[model samples]
Target: MDHLAFDDFPDGLIVAGPDGRVTYVNERVRKLARAEGDEMIGMPLAEAMPFDDLNGHTWMECVRPYDGLNTRSAILEQSWYSPRGSEYLITASLKRDRPGGRVQQVVIGIRSARVRNRHDRERSDLVATVAHELRSPLTGIKGFTSTLLTKWDRFTDEQRQFMLETVDAEADRLTRLIIDLLDAARIDSGRLTLKRGPVRLDELTERVLRSISAAGSEPSWRMDIGAVQTVWGDEDRLVQVFTNLAENAMRHGHGLRRVEVVEAEREGVHGVRVRMCDRGPGIPPEARQRVFSRFWRSGPGAGSGLGMYIVGGIVTQHGGLVDIDDAAGGGAQIDVWLPVNEPEALRDGDDRGSVIGSGTTRG
Candidate 1:
């Protein structure tokens, strides 16, 4: 094995002894520590590389022997300040190895995480502030529109009809924007709450299908519900999940005529696997990795990038996994996996639950 190759690795790497003393520091590690070549090699692990976690834990304290393995490991995020009064975020992982029956050899890898965290935090703050500012005006508009519609008999027929149509269109637009803002806020705060409950999968799928049909947008849409009777989850959130998937399929499915929802149990866990397959030009392989990212859209005509982001967040909050893959015959398929043991209480109206857990749909 070429030790030099390891030294040149992208992540910082350091080796420590059983006594928790640094024995070797790779080039990357030395550079990150801003230390001389020999300074880090002989010092105690804590003193040679001092770092503290966001929650105030020392770096060494967090890396324990890996559970059930001779090696211990941990990934830690810590902040460091430069002599010039600037701060940097560092993410480091330590792994203890027992190679050749030696238990004392510990390797630590470190990298910069400050820029990423800062960017994410800033974006979240912006979303929250924008959502808050927009809510009051949206509410006012919707309220006045409702009042006018209710007072329809007081106006002439022509005036009443025109007002009603204008109000209806404006209300719809406001509602969509509000929903987007809410989703953005929930995702930014990581506070979406889930009201989990035991739900019949068959009934839930049927309800979503009927609701989408009643909306009368996609008359040619088709849904296939599986035989799985019960799944543990928030029914409303789950509906939002499917609704987003179905809508995305309809909108981006390139004139997709039919949508399908399939259910099954796998490996003893009841799973409701909903696949929204469309006939549109399928997502390119290069962009598949980002399909679920926030504010990500495929092209100019694609809808707001928030839909898939909301879908991913909702499924994840339920302890389920969601992904986009190539459909069996054509188009992109959004597959969602929900655990059967998802709590029934998550479906209740507990607004304070985890923001990620609240399955709210966004347009």
Candidate 2:
């Protein structure tokens, strides 16, 4: 409604009159098309900023914006090449004063292809990671089952139990991988739901510690909890959040040392902050932001690298945040903030908690 609103828009925009001449554009369009001020004005829209596909068809020639079907009201976004060879995505809206009437104006939107390109690369990475992660477990499960069936009588009871246990563990690995993938999909689609209730942060960490230690030898760990308050979150998801963090500590931690949960205020929101500190090599300042990305790993490590990604997603879903920092003395310290109050949208029974930012999820 306001032309000025488009002044600072992230993407470029252009408007054309019924005659197909450039009538208006935002500041973004000038830099996007490399045009000087008012230079693009009055020229035919296509002539002013020509873009073409691989087949050499100009955008105007392909869309035939002024000559298309009267009922056609818009053009779907598609890839195009600028005259300078940079990639761009273009879409346009066709407006008519009356139903089935002649087109009055064409409003076009364009943005650099870098963002979409990055997303495509990330999706490709996800596919490759999922395929590789799935193959190892599937191979183990298949081999174990095949051997058991082919040599049913040759193995002793203890050997049989070990083989079966291996298969079981592989199956569990597969299940966890699938669940992580599902959670990732939900987060990306903004469909992640949180069943919120009061949750004790201190008890949650203790439970996570027990689970991790039960899996193997206990690491050198000490937990100090201050006067922390209960947080509003899904107990199961919160458990997942902490479990992932604690497990990370045990893996790369060389050995976990100090664990702390304390009450604090950030941006006026009172919440509980849980820090899982480890004695291993701490994350570098430059890499701190990347640890939470999908499939990110410190090095060649076990487990699907989706743990921290899912951690951030779940925390964001609960209107909280997560962060990685240098720990006391040495090693890494991961901080998770959980707000003590129910997210406004959660209180209204809507699952969209992305409106919440910093200090209760991850800063």
Top TM-score prediction, candidate number: 2
RMSD (Å) per prediction: 13.3, 7.4
Q: TM-scores of the models, in the given order?
A: 0.54, 0.75
Residues 258-292, candidate 2: write the lDDT tens digits.
Answer: 88888878799888898888989888999888888
* CA lDDT of every candidate: 0.64, 0.84
After TM-score superposition, the amount by which residue 238's alpha carbon in candidate 1 deviates from its true location, in angstroms, is 1.3
Alpha carbon lDDT at 281, candidate 1:
78
Q: Positional deviation of 231 in candidate 1, in angstroms?
A: 0.8
Q: Can you list the residue pairs that collide in candidate 2?
A: 320-360, 320-361, 321-360, 321-361, 321-362, 322-361, 322-362, 337-360
Candidate 1 lDDT, tens digit per residue, 175-294?
Answer: 775687687679769988877667765556667766766777655645554444356677887777777776776667764444444455667766666666778778887887687776
Q: Residue 280 in model 1: shift from native, Å?
A: 0.7
The lDDT, on a scale of 0 to 1, for candidate 1 is 0.64
**Clash count (model 2, backbone only):** 8
The backbone clash count of each candidate, in order, is 25, 8
CA lDDT, candidate 2, residue 348: 68
